[model samples]
Target: METLEGAELCFPQLLNTSCRKPLQHHAETIFLYILLSCISLLTVVLNLLVIISISHFRQLHTSTNLLLLSLAVADFLVGLLLMPLQILLIGGCWFLESFMCGLFYYASFILTSASVGNMVLISVDRYVAICDPLCYPTKVTQKRVQISICLCWVCSVLYNGVILNAFLKHPDRYNTCYGECVVVIGFITGAVDVILTFIGPIAVIILLYMKVFVVAVSQARAMRSHIAAVTLQGSVSVTAKKSERKAARTLGVVVVMFLICFCPYFYPSLVGQDMSTSVAFSIFGVWLLYCNSCLNPVIYAFFYPWFRKSIKLIVTLQILQPDSCYAHIL
Candidate 1:
C-alpha cells in the first residue's frame, strides 16, 4: 500500500493489508462494528421510547423531559444515520462524492456538538431547579426550554459547518473511490470543534454541577433546619425531598458518564499538539468517544427505575398483545 502524510495516518493503514494478522482481523472488526451499530441503535431506540412514552403519557411531560426528548432524537439520528457511515469511514471507505462526503461528516459533527451542548443545558437547568426551587418554574418555562434546545442545535450546526467548508476545498476533490481528505486543516478546525464539543460544554457542566452539588448539600441542611416545619407539613415535604434526591442521583450519573467518555478527546485538543498515538489508537479513541452515545440508555436502565418501568411496560403492552388486541389497548 502507498502512504500519504507523515507517519500519523500511516499507522492505521499499516495494519490493514500489509500485515498477516491485521488482514485477518478486518472481517472480525467489521462484524464487531455491526454489533456496535446495533447496540448504539438499541440505545437510541430506547431513549426514543422513553421520549415517546413520556410524551404520550402527558403526566410525565415536563421541560426536563422535553430537553431529554431533544437529546434522544439527536442521539437516535446519530445512531441511525451516522454510526454506520462512521464504521465505513473507519474501514477506509469514503463511499460518496466530495460534497456528499462533506455533508455527511459535517452532519455527524454538528449533531454530536448539539448533543453535548444540550447536556450542558440540562445540567444547568437541573441546578436551577434544585438550588432555587421557588424560582424554578418561572425561570425555566416551557418556551425558554424549547428556545434553548433550538439554540443548541443552531450553534452546533454553525460551528461544524465552518470546519466542513475549511476542509472541503481540495483541488483533486473528485468523484473517486480513493478517499482522500485534507486532514491537516482538520487538525486546527477539529481543535476548535473539540473545544466547542467538549471543553466549553464540559466546563459549563462541571461548574453548573458543582453548584448543583452544593445546592443539594444546602437543601439537605435546610431540611434538617426545618424539621419542625416539616413535622407540621406532614408527608408532602418528605415526598418532595425524595424526588429531589432522585433527580440529583440521575444528574450525578450523567456527569460521571460525561467525564469518563469525553475526557480522552478533550485534553489532546486543548494542548495544541498533534496526536502522537498510533492510527489504531486514534480510530479506537474516536469510537470510544462515541460510545458515550450508546451508554445513555444503559445508564438510564441502571439509574432510573422509571425509565426501565416505562420500557418494560411498553414492550409488554406492544409485543405481549397481538395486533388484533392492540386497538383495544390503545
Candidate 2:
C-alpha cells in the first residue's frame, strides 16, 4: 500500500508533503504536449509576422494598424511565454520557484487585460471611422493612437497588480503540498475581475460596434439613394464610404471571434466561483483563451490583402532591401 501510494506522489521522497501526480494515460500525455507545442509555435510565428509587417511598412502605419500592433504584442507574449509555461504545468507539477510563479501570473494578467483594452480601442476606432468619417483623420491620428495604446498597457499592469496583490505578496500561501502551483482569487475579487476584464469591456465593444453597424447601414442607404451634381466628387464619396464599410466588416469578425474565445474562459466567474488555475475546466478555458492568439493572424491573412502582401515580402526577404519600409503595400 505504501509503495502504491508513493507511485502516485509527484515527489516520493517528500512523502506526506508531496502532491499526487495526476493520472493520465502515457499516450494522452504525449498528444497534449504535441498539440500544445504546435499551437505555441504557430501563435508565435504568425503574430511575429503581423509585428514585422506593420513595423516595416510605413504604409501600414495608420491609426488602426497601431492598435493591431499592440494586440499582436500581447498575443506574441502569450505564445512566447504563457503557452510554454502552461504546457509545463499541464504535467501537474510546477518545478519553478515561488517568485517565478508570481511573475508568471502577473505577466499573464497584464497581457490578457491589455489585449481586451486593445480590442476596445479597435472598436472605438471603427466606430469613429464609420460614424464620423470626416472627423476620423483628426480624431484618430497616429500620435493619439500611440498614446492610447501606451495608456492601455499601463492601466492593465496597474489594475492586475491590484487584483492579484494577495497572491503576489505570498505566492505559496494557499499551497497544500510541494509540486503544486495554484492561484485562487477570492469570490469578491474574482467577481470584480470578471466585471472589469470581461463584462465591462465586452459591453463597451458590443455597444460601439452596434452603433458602427447602424451608422454604416444608414450611410450605405444614403449612398445608394442620393444623386450628386458632380461626378468626380460623388465617386470619391462612394469610395470612402465603401472603404469604411469594409473596415467595419473585417473588425466585426475579429470582435465576434474574441467573444467566442473569451466567454468560456470567464464562465466560472459568471457562475459565481472564484477563479482558479488548477481545475481541469479552468485549464481548458485557459488554453481556449490562448488559442485566440493563434487565430487572430489567420483572420488577418484571410481578410486583409495588405497582410498577405506583407507576408510575401517578408518571406522572400524583400523587406531587407533598401527603402523597403516605403514599399507600397496597400
| Candidate with the greatest TM-score versus the true structure | 2
Q: How many clashing pairs per prediction, in order?
A: 0, 0
Off by over 4 Å in 1: 1-27, 169-177, 180-191, 221-236, 274-282, 318-330
1-330, model 2: which lDDT tens digit per residue? 446464777777888888778878999899999999999999999999999999999999999999999999999999999999999788888888888888988998899899999999999999989877768888999999999999999999999999889899999887888878888888888898999999999999999999998988887787688843335423447777898799889989989999999898889899998778874864679998999999999999999999999999999999999999999998
Q: Model 1: per-residue lDDT, tens digit, 107-161? A: 7668778878878888878887777665777899999999999988888887766
- The CA lDDT at 45 in model 1 is 80
| lDDT value for model 2 | 0.89
Best by lDDT: 2
Question: Per-residue lDDT for 252 in model 2?
Answer: 93
